[model samples]
Target: MCTVCGCGDGEVKVHGHKHHSHDHSHTHSHSHDDGLHFGDGAAGVSVPGYSQERLIKIETDILAKNDRYAELNRAKLAAQEVFAVNLVSSPGSGKTTLLCKTIEALGGQPLAVIEGDQQTQNDADRIRATGAPAIQVNTGKGCHLDGHMVGHAIEHLTLSHGSLLFIENVGNLVCPASFDLGEDCKVAILSVTEGEDKPLKYPDMFTAARLAILNKIDLAPHCDVDLDLYTANLRRVNPTIEILNLSARTGEGMSEWITWLRTNLAQKQLQGAAE
Candidate 1:
C-alpha cells in the first residue's frame, strides 16, 4: 500500500494485460496503542505497526525507485524526441473532452495518448476515435500512475519521432502530484465549477505542475466563479506556473492551448537536433 495515501498496492494492467503486482512486504509488529496517532511522525503518516521513522524510510525508498524508473522513461522519450505532457486533474474536470478537441485541432500532427483510469477504456476509445493511437492503462485499486507503469505502457505504443504524447492521469489530484511519469511537464486542469480554492486545498498538485489550464471557462459566468481569484490562488501555490483559460466545448481559448503545445513540441525537437 502507498504509505502516504494508503492506496492499495493493487495489480496494474496495461491494455487488459496484467503488467505486474506491487507486493511490498513490511515487517512490523502487530501490536499498537489504543490511542492511535498516525500523524505524529515526521512523515506525518503512521501505519499500524510501523514507526514514523520507518514510514519515512519506506516512502523515501519508494520514491527513489520510482525516480530511477522515471529517468529511464525520460531517456526513452528523449531518444524519440517526444514532447510528453502529464495531464492531471480531479474527476469531472473535462480532461478527456479537451484532449479530443486538442487532437482535432492538431490535425495531421504526430501525436498519441496514454489514458489512465481505475477502470474502463472509455477515454481511450474517445482518443482512438480521433484517428490517433492510444493506450489504456487500468490501475485497478491504484490511485496514480507511476513511472514504472508508464514505462511499460510506452512499450505498446509506436510513437513517431518528434511527436506529442499526452498521459491523461487518473482523476485524483493528491497522489498523482508525487509520482513522476517521465513527462516533460505536468499540466493541471481545473474547471470553473470546481471552485477557486482548489489550489489552496491541493497545494502539492498545483505546486508540482508547470502549467494550469482553467477548463470550462464558458461556464464561469454562469457558475459565478471568479477567474481572477482562481489565477491568484494558483499563483500563490506556484508563482511561475503558466495559466490558460479555455473551454473545450466553446473553443473559446483552445487556439492558445494548441499554440502552447506546438511551441513546446518545437522546442523539444530543437533540443534533440542539438544533441
Candidate 2:
C-alpha cells in the first residue's frame, strides 16, 4: 500500500490523529503568480472573516480567468480542426512508446506531436523516426503541461486542417488534471504494471480523463495485475471513459486504439464544419 493510503498510514500515525490541515485546491490562472501570501496560521493569530472572504473572492476571480483562457484555447483548437489528445501518466508508463507506435499506426496522414518532459528530447527523437513533425518542450522543472505551453507549441507546429495533435504531457498525475491544454480530450494511459488500485488512488486523473488506454496487456501472463479490477476502478471514477487495452512493443490491441482515434478525428471534423 502507498504510504499516504489512509489515516493508519505512517505520517498520520505519528500525530495519533488523521486530520489533515487543508488540501489547497489551487488551479493556476493567467492572473495569479503566487509568490508567498503568508496567512495567520504561522503567527498563531486569528484573522477576521472579512479578510478570508476577500481572499476567497480573489481565488474565484483567478479561477474564472483560467476558465476563460481554457475556453479560448478550446476555440482556437476547434477552429484549426485538430484533435489534440494529452497523454498523461507516471514517468515510465509507456507514454513515449505508445506515441511511437501510435504515429506508426497512423501511417503519416498529418500528425504532429508536442513532447513535454523535464529534460531531454528522447521521446521527440522516437517520434521523429515515424516521420511526424514533433516539437520538444523541455519544462526543466515543471510537473505538468498547461494551455500556455500548448498554445506556444502550436506556433511551431506544422499542422494543417484535420491534423492530429498529440501532447504527451509531463509525467505527473495530479497537477496535469487541473490544466486544460486546449485539448479535445485528456487521454490517461495506465499500464498493467501500475496495478489495479491506481484509478482509485488517482481519482483526479481518472475523473478528468475522457478516455484511458491500459497499456502492456501483452505482459499480463508475466505479471499479476488484475485487469478486471483495474477496469472496474476506472469505470467507477468515470463510467463514460472509453477504455482500450494495448501493448505497443508487441503491436497487441493497436488496431482498436487507432480506430478509436480515427473515429474521433472524423467526428471532430464533422462538428467543426457544421459550426
- RMSD in angstroms, all models? 5.4, 11.4
Find the number of clashing residue pairs for candidate 2.
Answer: 0
What's the distance in Å from true for residue 55, model 1?
0.5
Assess the local accuracy of residue 109 in candidate 2 as a C-alpha lDDT between 0 and 100: 67
| lDDT, candidate 2, 137-210, per-residue tens | 75544566556656666666667989898989988876678677778889999889988999999898889999
How far residue 63's Cα lies from its native spot in candidate 2, in Å, is 4.1
**Candidate 1 per-residue lDDT over residues 28-105, each given as its tens digit:** 211123323232135466566877776665667677778888999999999999999999999999999999999999
TM-score of candidate 2 relative to the true fold = 0.80
Name the weakest run of 10 consecutive residues (lDDT summed) in model 1. 22-31
Stretches of model 1 off by over 4 angstroms after superposition: 16-43
- Assess the local accuracy of residue 42 in candidate 2 as a C-alpha lDDT between 0 and 100: 24
How big is the positional error of residue 80 in model 2, measured in Å on the Cα after superposition? Answer: 2.2
